[model samples]
Target: MILTVTLNTALDITYRTAALTPHATNRVAEVTERPGGKGINVARVLAALGHESVVTGFVGGRTGDALRELLAAEGPGGKAAHAAVSDSPVTDALVPIAGTTRRTIAVVDETTGDTTQLNEPGPTVTPAEWAAFLTSYEGLAARADAVALCGSLPPGVHVGAYAELVRLARAAGRPVLLDTSGEPLRRGIAARPDLVKPNADELAQLTGSREPLRATRDARRRGGRAVVASLGAAGLLAATPDGSWRAAPPMAVRGNPTGAGDSAVAGLLSGLVERLPWPERLARAVALSAATVLAPAAGEFDREAYADLLPRVAVTEQSSQPEQESHATRQHR
Candidate 1:
């Protein structure tokens, strides 16, 4: 089973609008809320794809309770709902916390098809609380085939938290995939995760290279055995141990782009565990991402879209880079 870790969990609220103007009041056309985070989103896609995935993370207070309730919900924003439906029915288990969880707001403009986001810092996790999380991780990692350390960390947590998680997953003999940005990605890479999925901006920030290909190359050298760089609607670039390649979607899908990267991570990890070939893996990854774009709801992907796109993804392999140190040198923030 795949295990997903989210440090800064949130009650994600999305409001659709005809248009949004800064410093002006606007009525929302539609509103939806869910238990939201990178890992949680991944688990949803995995479940929809007929895979078993466990989501573990820091959740707290009333917001946390509501988040857990939502995670267990059926219909659209289901997290563990797929498991209960497909496999043996089981309740979603989102661990409780001492501090109140945060809320993430996304304003989706209908006209431009762009989203404006505002994120809270999230609650603080004390030292004792963090230790508790380690214990939880150990238990979860023991049963995890793949563990994903995903998204931004909360306040009062060290930036090296993902690094520690990577080490734990490694010790448990499970391959780990890390997806985060800025300092967390930089620090986590030092621990050498089995795989890492970073978008163009995140890659540029870590490697200090504006050029996307150069940045991905640098990222591969640093610590990732394989680097899967998400390039939005354009496609994905994967640098694996044996070789590197690019997976392009059949078309520039027009829809919501949110949560596409998380879908790609689920696709890659699920493919790896199934022992699928690289071509198939990249194809699945691209399909999942493309499906996510088609999903209008925040953090959700359409299963039918994924199935339709899976066979259409084009995977072309490229030459692997010669052995050398990664040139990624970020001015440490």
Candidate 2:
């Protein structure tokens, strides 16, 4: 089983309008909502790939109830309850809090394929709630093949929250993956997670370097056993203890990229659990990310797109020497 921790969960809402203009009222033509936050997105992708996953996070109020309902409704055999079934069922192990879960609104412009996001601050988590979460996490980690700690910390939770989670997972001898940003990421990296996935901007913010390779190495120096930096359309640049590699998509894909990072996380975690080689893991991540862009909605990946992109992605080994940055040690397509 795989355990995914989303400290701050949300009810994601996407509204599509004909066009978006500043200071103008636009009528929405369609609306879609789902259970979201980075970890939740990762779990969904994992489930799609026939992996049993359990999602644990904070939930409260009516919105939280609705989120749970949506999750339950999507369970195996299209069941109406939160009961697990055969194949890749997602089990809901969300911790209840006092405040209501937040809502994230994405306004998509049909004319330009651009998205404007308005996110609400999640409900504050009390000390008691945090304690309960830690206890639950420990138990889940013990049973999980791999654990993922993802997204932001809710209000009232300590900044070292992820750091504590990482420590606990490691103590249990579980391979842990972390995906987040800012101070939370900095502090969590110090706890030495098995892997850390960050985008170009987050890597730049943490290491103060715009260069993906250098920033990835800097991130690893901060205590990540391996670092995978998402470079948007350029694909992934990974620095692992074994070696360094870069995976690029065969062609540029344009669409809603909101959940591309989470899809990449799912790909990497799946590859790790399957014991695939580093280069293959990177290839899978890149393919999944590109497939996600082809999906019509966030948190979904196009199966056909992923299959087609899998073998087309180019994976090239990078020289350990900084001076040989331009040289590809080996290339696989």
Candidate 3:
């Protein structure tokens, strides 16, 4: 099973309205709530794609209870939904804590296709709570095929949390993927994870360069075995030991982009577990990311869209000297 770690789990609530205006109240036309946080989102996508994935991290209080129930609920947007259709289901191995889990709100403007988000800082995790999590993670990591260390550290937790998790997962001989931002990402990269998935902005913050190719190289230099940088609508640009390549969607897609990155992580993880070639893996990652943007909800990918884009995603092998030439000068098949 693939293991995912989310230090700051959240109850994600989405609201839709006709339009959004500053300083004006708007009536909600639709509402949807589900379990979220980067790792949980990744686990949901992996489960949908028929991959066995176990989610681990901190969760507690009444909000945490709701998140767990949502994970196991039978109808829709839950584990039973995936279990009803597929053999692989998402497992919740979340640890309980003293503080209540946080909630994040996304206000979607249907008319303009824009989203305004309000994310709460998650519950503080004490040192004892952290110790308990480490114990749980050690057991879970031992039995997993691969592990993804994801999301932000909760309050009171040290910034080096992901770094330490990377070390532990690596010591267990498991292929580990680190997905996070800020100081957690900065420190985690130094632990030399199997892969690090950072979006363009996050990559820039880490490497001091907005240039995708340059920043990806710089990130790898810091310690990732490989770096896959998400370039939003431009798709993904990866710098790996095998070679560098850029994958782009066939056409521009428009929709809510909340969990697109998580879907990409799912695609990459799935490919790694299946031992697909780097180009093929990148193609799947790009297709999944595009499909998620086209999906109505976060973490859901339209299978038809993915299939349509799979072969159409433009994959170009990049040159060895990225610093010498711009990506626009690269050739494509």
Which lDDT values do the candidates have, in the order given? 0.83, 0.90, 0.89
Off by more than 4 A, model 2? 79-87, 323-333
TM-score of each: 0.90, 0.93, 0.93
Measured by lDDT, the strongest candidate is: 2
- Report the C-alpha lDDT of model 2 over 1-333, residue by residue, as the tens digit: 899999899999889999988898889998877788999889988988899999998999999998898887676776532222234888999999999999999999888888899999999999999999989989999999999999999999999999999999999999999999999999999999999999999999998889788789878989999999999999999999899999999999988788999999999999999999999999999999999998876768888999999999999999889624423422221
Candidate No. with top TM-score: 2
Better of 2 and 3 by TM-score: 2
Residue ranges of candidate 1 with Cα displaced over 4 Å: 75-93, 321-333
Candidate 2 pairs with clashing backbones = none
Residue 150, candidate 3: C-alpha displacement in angstroms: 1.2
User: What is the Cα-based lDDT of residue 209 in candidate 1?
Assistant: 77
Each prediction's RMSD to truth: 4.0, 4.7, 4.1
Q: How would you encode candidate 3's per-residue C-alpha lDDT over 1-333 as one tens digit per residue?
A: 999999899998888999988798889998777888999989988887888889999999998998898877622344443322334677889999999999999988888888899999999899999999999999999999999988888999998999999999999999999999999999999999999999998999998889888889889889999999999999999999999999999999998687899999999999999999999999999999999999876668888898899999999999887655544443331
Q: Quote the lDDT for 58 in model 3.
A: 93
